[model samples]
Target: MSNLSDIIEGFIKELLEANSQRAIEIQRNILAQQFDCSPSQINYVLTTRFGNDKGYMVESRRGGGGYIRILKVSTSIEEELKNFLNESIGDSVTLNKALDLISALRERKIITDREQRIMQSILGDRALKGVVYEDRNKIRADVLKEMILASAENDM
Candidate 1:
């Protein structure tokens, strides 16, 4: 058996896979019991492992009869990559937002973990040293656009 968090993640993924729509709903209390963990543990897995960057949408209710719903969005990675180029990112992007884009690509399975790390290394502040803030952001934007385009091309 794997770690508790991994086991819980696997179980939820199994349920999602077994369904036709790639979605699933469950009571947090029930899931916690099944995993022999606290309800918070279940929440931790859901938030960190199944974040938006991970290509999941989560909804939940607070009280009794409340349920947690996980929906796997059907989106094209290339489209999102383009959107970033055309909209989200301006001439420059903040480090945090840049990393978010990378994480989203990884979550979408458009890029591998190695790719994410490589992008971060090449686009991080250190790589833009001596450049003014404005120019650095512009450089970051260009680099990210090129990388995303290359990745999208490879996918096609």
Candidate 2:
């Protein structure tokens, strides 16, 4: 059985997929009622899943007539790649950001399904066993850079 958090996440994901522009408040009460959970439970899901780093922007209001607005920031994989290349990709990028970037690339068709699987396998925590977090991040960045460079060269 799915946990409450997972259930809530799935519900919110469905809502976003069905109507990306729908305000969060529109479904809050209904979702709470359906899940038999408190309003704050909904809030917790929103904060954790719809965070800025996850490429979602959430705005909410409190009190009567208040609303919660959720926006999916559509970002290009090429733009994200450029950002990753230019920014100080610290010793270990958070797992969430790395996954988000990979997902974006897959969505944009920048990476083939096979390549994604390979990359995932190589960068997986198990593969990085014995390495410290910081070192693992550095290794991941190096590997990612190499892959991106090869992909670019192939495209050229």
Candidate 3:
């Protein structure tokens, strides 16, 4: 049998799939009670499995009527890529963020699996080992930005 976290994740994903908007809001206490676990456990599954890298955004309100809002990223590939380039990334991007961007691109079929592996390899920590800690993110961001722009130009 799957663990509680997996079960919870599956349940939430099912909800998202069932909704046309691909978004859902659930009260933490209500969900916890339904799952027979603590609210913190639900939070753990959310943070680890539904992060931007995994292609989901989670927003939570804390209070007596707190609700967790989960949104699956937009499916329009071109618009999504533009948003990422203009807003999600800036002068510097962490390795995880870069990986997330790459993963999203792969998920959307914007980039092939081979391209995904190549981009990941090029932008990974090992590839940046020679750079100073302070400069790694900046270099990664620059490389990613250029790669995306180049890909866009080629597609045109």
RMSD of each: 3.8, 4.0, 3.3
TM-score of 1: 0.68
Work out the TM-score per prediction: 0.68, 0.65, 0.72
In angstroms, the error of model 1 at 11 is 2.2
Ranking by lDDT: 3, 1, 2
Clashes of 2: 0
Q: Candidate 1 residues 1-156, lDDT tens each?
A: 689988998899889889998889899999999888999999999987786656678999989899999998776766666655777566778887789888878866788999899999989989889788778878888888888788778776
Candidate 2 ranges with C-alpha deviation above 4 Å: 20-30, 83-91, 94-112, 129-134, 145-156
lDDT of candidate 1 at residue 128, scale 0 to 100:
82
lDDT tens readout by residue for model 3, 1-156 = 999998999999999999999899999999999999999999999998787756789999999988999999875556666777877678999999888888767766677898889889999889889999899999999999888776666554
- lDDT tens readout by residue for model 2, 99-148: 66566557556778888777777777788888887688778777766776
The TM-score, computed over Cα atoms with residue i paired to residue i, of candidate 2 is 0.65
The model with the greater lDDT, 1 or 3, is: 3
Select the stronger candidate by TM-score from 1 and 3: 3
Q: TM-score-based ranking, best first? A: 3, 1, 2
Model 1, residue pairs in steric clash: 92-137
